[model samples]
Target: MSEWFYQESQTESFLEREFVFANFLEAFAFMTKVAILSEKNDHHPDWRNVWNKVYIKLSTHEANNTVTDKDRNLAEEIDRIL
Candidate 1:
């Protein structure tokens, strides 16, 4: 997968990804992992969950709407967990 970090805005660009899990348990497990990483890095993702699906949109709040290395790094971590 490409490690491309795009700028964040009040749009849905960051929501266009393919993340699938077999069941709710698997999805919740991934979310738990992500939550820990987010706390460690102090960078949270705007996300929602419905059953087995997770929607993630990341942005650097202190950096306005621009995407930074931190976002990419967190995304890598998330990909690893998933």
Candidate 2:
């Protein structure tokens, strides 16, 4: 997706993006919202939050940790969450 960056390792590929919030609480709230949606869609993200920033990475683990349509779709949904 336009908002994400593509990354690859020797054995895996993923899409990554970053979001910044006004404060830690705001960022945590956003992450909670994303977690619920991820569970509902059965597609969880690899993510971390520090202070006001949330970094997210998406990949389909069942697909050998590669980026797939599932990752793209999830990325779009995550954007909507923002």
In candidate 2, what are the lDDT values of residues 5-35, reduced to their tens digit? 9999999999999999999999999999999
Give RMSD (Å) of candidate 2 vs. truth: 0.8
- Residue pairs in collision within model 1: none
TM of each candidate vs. truth: 0.79, 0.94
Where model 2 places Cα greater than 4 Å from the true spot, the runs are: none
Best by lDDT: 2
Model 1 lDDT, residue 36, Cα: 99
Candidate No. with top TM-score: 2
Model 2 steric clash pairs: none
lDDT of each: 0.72, 0.93
lDDT of 1 by residue, 1-82 (tens): 2643454457433422445689899888988998999999998888888888877877666766456677778888887875
Candidate 2, TM-score vs. the true structure? 0.94
